[model samples]
Target: MRASIESEDRGNSMKEQIKYGDDVLEIELPDDIIVDRVAPASHGGAKACHSLRDDHAEDTYEYLYGKIHQALIHASTRIEKCGKIVIACDDNTRVTPVKQLVPPIIDFADARGIPAEIIIAGGSHRKMTRMEREKKFDKAIMDRVEIMDHEWKEEAVFSNVGTIHAGDESIPLLLNRIACNHDSFLMGIGNIVPHSVAGFSGGYKILLPGLSCEETVRWVHYLISKFPSEAILGIADNPVRRTINSVHQHRKIDLLVNTVLDGSSRVVSLCLGNPITAQAQGASISRRVHGVPVNTPGDIVITDSVPESVDFWVVAKAVTNTKAFTRKGGHLIVFGPCDEGLSPMHGDALKRMGYDAPRNIRSRVKGGDIPREFLLEASHACQVGEVMEHCHLHLVASGLDVDAMASIGLHVITPARASSFVRELIEITRNEVTGRKPRVKIIHRGAEILPLQ
Candidate 1:
């Protein structure tokens, strides 16, 4: 059920059409390039929130609040007398619907006479604007609770917890001072999905990259890059995740509430309990919903980035997820409308450190060539380099110009020119090889799907 060619469309100019958010991209393949398959979109039994709300009207808040209450009571040793609670939530870039979960959580804490505040886990990303904050939270909740943004660059706001020894090198675990010194309980809220680095999103990730200092974020990403095999899409338990969970031993994160959302961003399943335990349960549901099994690797795989894929930093996930299903020296083309360009915050860093091959970048980093300010940039460059080493990557995006694409080691193409460009490239490659047409595969919402081997 992974991919199938439409028998009726075999004779037509259009080979495939995919949904890219609210837009549709129609791909027309030339005679020389044969499309082997077009994968079906993964459906996770997701339903519209309004329908779910109506169906479970009497049980909605009761079911959700019960779970949240049980998790806090079971996980926290001082829930009865806890004074302050910090809820770490995803920012605008993530697909998580923070508004849905925050209101109920605030109500629960207020009833207990515990003061609760929300911190936007911006990580290395830019801070959310006031308008964005207003849109993300309900008016009632915003008026009562203090909403703060995490500032990764502010040194005074971070406190050193301890150091994690990863071989000879030790990584310091510096967290947001408010989060690290929470008077009572800490809760992390996020949606579980396939992640390129930490196997899956959510769990302590809401703490590490979500709330930790810039140095901690850089070290964690670098660690994941060191082990490519384990740190891949659709994976559940990996070294990167293990390292993040290890922090719980030193710093206590009481309760974690992770949800599995469908294509419409409706919650299909909700997990509550220990951070690692809840995340694992949520990931299990995500794998079944998003995992697509492929019989064999394709010579050329084209993916459409959707949802929040408005920047290269966000949309590059399509490249990471599809890398496993792509053959060596093959092509992986991502088509999207990246209106924000590379990234609002990290674009300059990515441009300065060109996407050299991973091996070369690693050598330079080990040799002390990459400055401290560019460490995170180097990690991103390393990931792009690693993907490029395996496949010839291309991007058909409107926001980034040709030079910007080339600067990051991506071949640029436009929606109008894609057909001819693909045909020409395939024809040349076919002639050099056995003159056999390249086997192509198309994935709709590629960033959201997890291709399983």
Candidate 2:
């Protein structure tokens, strides 16, 4: 039988409620016990390694899951018989969502006679195909964690009470059903960002996608990630901010631990305990350490140290950097650090454009009607050699065929010689042209050419 809630500290409680974004959870504990769980977004790489260490010192020498295991151990150690513990985490195969990290934790928790239920938190969110879910979260966690039925539940919302102000808008937070509660410390482990909702990141959000249903998740994602330019993943005023506010109201999760990332997405600093306070402290460090803006563009420009991800896809991200600033044909110099190959979409597009790539790319403008054979022929037309011959292409590559570029009658330079060549080109252009030197553009890491006028 389910237990009913009763308040104990009626006289001493100041305000009976508080706000998180748009939602408000109770100020007084509904029961004598309560537990809040938050699992943050995971971007695998070096940053995660550093982030793990900084947040939990005892587990600093331990790997990512080591701390997670400790949290489980702590929760299990404290909760008595019938006392509840809720764990929210990503479906990542390696470190979370219980199956991978829990067997040991669960076995430990179970041994202590504490029963636990796992809940999938996505509600009305798009459901992951079973296969997709299985691949991401191993069967072990899937089996033990109680997957919340996202489809049938009433919409989750925050109570209207105290609100956080963002510009002119005021978001409301509301109380929701009690999932689990305990007197032990409330723990939140994850990364933080300037989200569209929940003001700064780190808090109630870890559970939505981490535990929610696929359709519920998909629906929310569609809204949050809608306009790419208007809403970056970690930017403000995006749908996520509103949603975050709507669900987590005045929960006052005890501890929020996170990492600030660097340019290579490395974790340069760590923030722990109390998101309201910790987020403010970490934001400063993030800006100073990893927030270098792209350089201002000039006419004929060369970009150095561009991310290799630029060439990985047909949709080049360079347009976002300086495509508008660059003048057509006016030489955009690219520096390469790419040992990895180009994006398949990009390769396919090149092939369809008559470049000699293996895959046939269908034209987006033609609505996939262009035959594959035609695409192959077009692929042949835009070969690297042909592009160099027709357009004023200057290539500086480490392992690329520089001689082939020279044979095609275009300027070619080895990686080492590029700086001098650029310097000479600048000198020659400045001498020929009168009024201020024509802008010379240089891109450090060149992958794909963004055709921006």
Taken over the whole model, the C-alpha lDDT of each candidate is: 0.72, 0.37
- Model 1 lDDT tens row, 1-453: 122332122333565675554577676676545565434333333332122222434343455656666666564457655678888888877767666667667776787787888888878888887776777776677898998989998899998999875434588988898788747578888888788777888888888888888888888877755766424566787777888887787677777777777655656667776788778877777776667676566677878876557788888887777776678888888887777888888888777777888778888888888676677777777777788999889887778898767765777787777666666766666665574556677766577667777
- The number of the candidate with the highest TM-score is 1
What's the lDDT of the predicted structure labeled candidate 2?
0.37
All predictions: root-mean-square deviation over Cα?
Answer: 4.0, 20.4
Number of backbone collisions per candidate: 0, 76
- Give per-model TM-scores: 0.87, 0.40
Span of ten consecutive residues with least summed lDDT in model 2 = 31-40
1-453 per-residue lDDT for model 2 (tens digits)? 001111222223132221111232222222111111111122232223223333433332234345545545554444554355454433221122233344554565566665555434433223446775676556775686554333323345322234443334343332223332434333444544333222234445554433333333334433422233223323433455555534345444444445554433334445644454565465444333322233333444444323332231211233223333344444544444222223322344333343321122223213654443333223222233232332244544443445543443334456556655655655555565576434443332222122121
State in Å the error of residue 161, model 2. 9.2
